[model samples]
Target chain A: MMGLHKKDLNLLLIVMVLALFAPFILNPFPTDSALAQFNAGYPDLMQRFVIFGIFAVGFNILFGLTGYLSFGHAAFLGIGSYSCVWMFKLLSYNVVPGILLSVVMAGIFSVAIGFISLRRSGIYFSILTLAFAQMSFAIAYSVLSNPAFNLTNGETGLQVYASDPQWLQSASAPNAPHLFGLPMRATETLTVGGWDFQFNVGYYMCAIIMILAFYLSIRIFRSPFGLMLRAVKSNQQRMIYTGLNTKPYTLAAFIISGMYAGLAGGLLSAMDPLAGAERMQWTASGEVVLMTILGGAGTLIGPVLGAGFIKYFENIFSKINDNILHQWFSALPDGLEDFLITIVHPFIGKGWHLTLGLMFMMVVIFLPGGLVEGGQRIGAMFKRKPKDTNGGLSAPATPAE
Target chain B: MGILEVKNVNKRFGGLQALGDVNLDIQENTVHAIIGPNGAGKSTLLNCLIGKLEPDTGSVTFDGQPVLGLKPHQINQLGISRVFQTPEIFSDLSVLENVLIPCFAKRDGSFRMNAIGTVGNETDVMSTAEKMLDDVNMLDKKDVLSGALSRGDKRRLEMAMCLVQEPKLLLLDEPTAGMARADTNNTIELLKEIKASRDITMVIIEHDMHVVFSLAQRITVLAQGRPLVEDTPEKIKGHPKVKEAYLGETAA
Candidate 1:
């Protein structure tokens, strides 16, 4: 409907619906219920779900379409966050300027990084990106946060302090990060029986932006440029021989994805008004890769699903402490309960990374095309999931290959 | 005077003279065949023409313009298209997409940020690509992944990809290299049809004399990095140097 093919339109609609109604979809359990801890509807976690979804969606444009994996994508995200926080410090907590600057700054940095990194492809490209990300992390963590010129504020992170010159901020305007007059932290709680559903302004803002980002990605996936990106991934030799330049195409995709990552980073600080050097850490970069791969790297909706999946595990699974585990297994015999907790202990709570790692391995090994392929398989089992009418052809193929 | 001129092009690899003082004149609207035994510098000469390799000395020009330092894509943008020896079609793409890429490249320059418009919306380009596929007898298989196609189909798809661009010069490097007899005959017929249907110049490099005789109007036989003979296909059939270039290798 939105200049997309019917199939893409349907996919976009599904994502929009899911994002818009995420609070209800995520909060199935009542507040008093034993499963309430699993509820991911809280604004903090919900905002993260969409923000990282934007990040992975953008990452997929580079890694998924052109098959250029940048191991240091989080540098752009960190740049976005820092730019956003700088806006809050200098201007106001209005968020519009911060987000815009974040995207621009990320684009500029990506042009520099991508220009150099794209010189080599395959594992070399990946290693180059990794090196750049590490350097950026080091610079942001220590160099930029020096006492004489405190930008990132070292490990303390950059936040909107009251003493900071917020020249654009009005006396009546909300002091916290906000859109116009609406505070990002503003929330409405709907109580029904033992269920409490949160409707947070910040989460909605992120959700709306994520939906737009997703729509743009869909348009890109359907476009001629998207086809060329796929062609670049398939056979660069053929592309060059066919009179198509590969450099500008790859560079554009890199910058575009960088801007997307920056937008995501800007959203991160817009919600909390805190910019940490840790956001640029290699692990954060790896997390987006995990999200893209775990969900399905190239698929239109796969990255978002992967982002939500990993964030859910990171937040909800990590919250399951020893007491929560003991309470769940209390009905069992004392010895057996203790044994179960011991076995499960290393895979949950503080060790939730173990569970995530196992799940990632299973996805890679079993569903090599990621979760999207798994969905397509199930859809095919019922009937040949009507093949995508246009550029969505990348879905049915094995992504790992 | 011809459309493409190669003048004293010399390319050396350490002690080996890959292509030494190679000279050729390829005319427009003709199928010119370049036949040589292995390591006779036929591929090297072709590489020089396509910008894959730069000759150490001398100039290669297409349509009176110097093409010596141009990039591969730049060479292509100047209306020179090459079909590789091993059918280098986009394996992951559909047959239609394989042709569509060159069409986009032909219409748009070397680099275009056409990120906003849908490919499906490009009705003119789509029709052109489909027409090329139809000419190659691959319209029915346009949706089929180019990788999964039979050898003959891949060859034809590659042909479609090149022909869709409608380049002034089409370079074919061993177009029927490893094909079975039936597939070879089909490719020959396809080439004949393509030649008859358009105002295109084709320069084919081949070891197969049957293909060389069937399609080439003019022939150039090379031996030891130099052109031994340039004649019509009939005269080339009985040329003594051409015989020595082929039969001498076996006798030695």
Candidate 2:
């Protein structure tokens, strides 16, 4: 079981099965049906789900384990994306070198940022990270994209120009980002009945990488280092008094999560060879925080769940406009149809954030441990029924529901 | 030479002289007690020894090496472990994990990545932690969250955490500060059993004469941040200076 405990192994297997069959699972609605717009089987959105899943999984290492809330993790992601695009521009369209370079570059920056930011814990640490991320966004937007040194390519974003020297690219090789001869954009469409399922090379790659990242996260959660990180969160005073240094432990978690974000950013560019200054924005960092918290910050599967939840809403919910709303409520009476659309309009389309906000609030209030806790509670409820059935059979005097 | 030596230790917090020219020696394999009333600077002295506070003037050495200016973790690595008046276990973690952390710290020095392998696979550390928990009679509750444990159990778990490291010096700050009689006796018995089984030095700071007299071999009475007397517990019980400072009664 790859050195995993039985419980963790089962969890990993479940994730793997779900990821491998996502195209089918996500596209339950037929293409010709009105609900087809809700199907998230497309390559672009599917790739984002796993990529952000990787980012949140990594963020959980630092924020969840060590209880250090970082508000600047997106800086590393931007650095990763930029490094990836630079590779595509100089080294070839092959994603291997770009992804590897992105991880390394993110690790370096994380070390520098983590070393400074980790000096202060709690809100101070968060503010410091926020400051660093904002600075990076500003620099990437204007400073680095200047004519003299266009590292990030400024507001227009960094992309591979045809005129740029791609030293390792061969004439026969795919012009787009690829692994060997397989282009990332390559996809096979499978039509069964009215459903259209997309099996994209890029999505599969991201999924495989996400699975690996998840496995690594599971290992870290069960490792001595992960225990130490949890100890850092629970009682840093106790940790220090017990002869454990908190500095290197927190810094290591920070660097590790940074590398994960970097890999995610690299994947983002690999899917579409563009690195934008907005990739490093504070809002991007905030989104990962939301994903981790919404999924269950400390749990192994929580971040992935949170990532999928947010990404699904962002993609599907936002795609529903007045036309779609009108189409869905067309069966109702004319007055009621317009009324229903009016009520739903504020929660969809450009107002998708309103829906996400309401859900996030509900999750925070009712399920403090996030979706994982909600699932566990439901599971416990089902388990309680069997035991209660035996007791209920014998207890004739007791009131039965 | 004693295992720990404090010479002319003076610590000032702003205008207040918290510890004024304090000096003492703690020998190996013996329980030493520091007894004083409130504001007698017992906690401050313990903080100084453990590197939580810097003394303005003094040389505190453990095993002939100066511990001044070292961080708490560094001092801990030098074989000194402190048990707080309130147990400081990792509350969010399991009881077993609470004990296992100290074992890792003892083996891995200050920091090691140790990220690839599973904690369950560290059979040696796992066994050591289990044995320590067994020593504290908490083996069955290993899976229980440390936060959910009763206060007495929390203290025992904290003891196990410190003892798993097998430090040269174990400092207890009011080990039975607010315990009921039954819990206090249990702690006393636990400490007695630990003392009988291990070759370790203990320094206890307490206001409770019952716990102090039950465990301490040597007693040092402090008054107004100065060491008034150091003697065997039997003699310390009869010392007139101890009667005056500790008993709150004027002794002629």
Candidate 3:
């Protein structure tokens, strides 16, 4: 019975189309253009954008609607990644088992964490989650480090071998694994424009699962369960007196978000075919939080954009160096070039995070709603008269429809 | 059996006895009012009944089942709903969405994990919420943000929210607390109308005598965490103890 608003649906369609064609849009810079330093259209980064987008989207489900700030969501991501790698090592190289294992592991971990953490709310809840995540990280770094060294190859990480069983295909076979016995690889790719997109077989697999995750999140956002979550955020005491159980609702949101994180973790290892304990680090969890906040916490599309934004910056900025900055500024007058180089120097080479941190602070202080809000503002400015009375810059009221 | 029964319920907060040896029985399909001065443990009693505060002793039964120790949502599932003194509807949600939430709870029980179904597409929830809002004369303001509504309209929306749940026993903690006189009268009239149309039991805590006298068939007066008297509205108006504790000696 729940459907997106027509405007929201249109916006979602636009985002989907854009994500699909991001490679082309990002490839606009000439082979040696200065902007090429910022290009993130490559397959590796694009894949990361989607995976982390899943992470942020999941975080938003709990933080945005429920207003519960969790500082330990990275634990679930790390668990997912670890479980996924274990699946690949023990079961098969096929990603399906790995992703499923990740989701299950993350979900079980969340249940235990949520049960204990949900006993407190507000700052306490945040601290509780942080403690749990830190504990997990420490354990993973110590006890699991040895097994992971053997299993995941420790910090060295695990990689698939070419001689490893292609569970999806047998050697000397013309076709990939069949369902039971039927050919499964036939429907893999649908290429266009002479760009050999394999569907990668794996890429399409992740895409289908991402779509499912997106759809599930959308449903939860509109369902009565989501209503209870918002109610819990608004006035928990009132909910209790109104005869509503706030605890279970909060727990459900926590678990759901954890599962999504796990899914993202699984997908990451699947694509890269390795899992390191670093994936479970607190900073990785913080990155998703940043992405969610940067994209707009409550809105569906915000987290995706936030994920893309952060990943894009990471990919592009990491590639730029002092030489690249110098080459661009060399065209200017001597003094101007020196000033320009000074201005841009810190943001290039090893200082990429400095730029990103500054941008994040600006966004938080000025536009807490993230890039989605920024986009909406730009769209509104173009559509309305300059002196429009509505003052469209204010946060869009959540449509009660 | 009474619709709701609380017997010998005792609650203590550290050393302070918030409620001690409290007892009350609310009849079916009647408005029952509890009136007391500030710090008389009126809110504590409400909290104990709804399981927000566990009573150190005694039991609460709704319809024939023990409601003590049950979660709030579990109590709601037993056909009990409450509206807080301050308007508690989701502020960001529209008036309609606020009412629709309780309606969903009534139909779907306490918890639902279905994350794919469209909420607004539920025809029955919309129609029922619409009807409830109409009963409270708030159908016109259904689409407005509940937080933006005037105090009176907000009260109306809260009432509508409770009504949509089809609660057998409605516990309202001062439904007309901060409204202007005109709005107060309107709310009184709305309560009277709802009482007439539905066979719903009510336990209301009120500071305002006019709203209480108009709606409550029975009145319970509390003083210092104990029930001073429980009597018919007429007797309560004349009772010497109630007059001394609440209504004032001159009124008696």
Top candidate by TM-score = 1
DockQ of 1: 0.62
**Can you rank all candidates by lDDT, best first?**
2, 1, 3
Candidate 3, which CAPRI tier? acceptable
Off by over 4 Å in 3: A1-5, A147-152, A160-169, A172-205, A385-401, B14-17, B246-252
Q: Give all TM-scores, in the order shown.
A: 0.97, 0.96, 0.88
Q: Which candidate do you rate higher for lDDT, 1 or 2?
A: 2
Q: Return whichever of 2 and 3 wins on lDDT.
A: 2
Comparing 1 with 2 on DockQ, the higher-scoring candidate is: 1
lDDT of each: 0.92, 0.93, 0.77
Q: Write the per-residue lDDT of candidate 1 for residues A1-401, one digit (tens) a residue.
A: 77987778888889999999999999999999999999999999999999999999999999999999999999999999999999999999899999999999999999999999999999999999999999999999999888799878989998888899999999998989999999999999999888899999999999999999999998888788999999999999999999999999999999999999999999999998999999999999999999999999888899999999999999988999989989999999999999999999998888999999999999999998899889978877999656665454333222222
For model 2, residues A252-276, the per-residue Cα lDDT tens digits are 9999999999999999999999999
lDDT of 3 by residue, A1-401 (tens): 12775755665566666666565665655545556556665566767877887888899899988999999999998888888767655655556677889999999999999999999988999999989998887777666557434444555765555555545444444332222333323333333443323223344445556655665677677777777787777767656655566788899999999999999988888777667777777788788889988888888888888998988888778788778777877888989988988888888667888989999999998887788778877877889645633233222336211
iRMSD of prediction 2: 9.1
CA shift of A255, model 1, Å: 0.2
Summarize candidate 3's per-residue lDDT along B1-252 as a digit string, tens digits: 799999998888898887878999989988999998888899999988776778899999888999887877787788887888888877877777778777777777666665666667778888998888887787766766677777777777888888887789898899888878998898888888888888999999999999899899999999878899999999988888987876566765
lDDT of 1 at A227: 90
For model 2, residues B48-140, the per-residue Cα lDDT tens digits are 999999999999999999999999999999999999999998988888889999999999998999899899999999999999998888887
Between candidates 1 and 2, the one scoring higher on TM-score is 1
Single-chain TM-score of chain A, each candidate: 0.96, 0.95, 0.86
Evaluate fnat for each of the predicted models and list the values in order.
Answer: 0.73, 0.77, 0.47
To one decimal, what is the Cα RMSD in angstroms of model 1 from the true structure?
Answer: 2.6
Rank by TM-score (best first) = 1, 2, 3
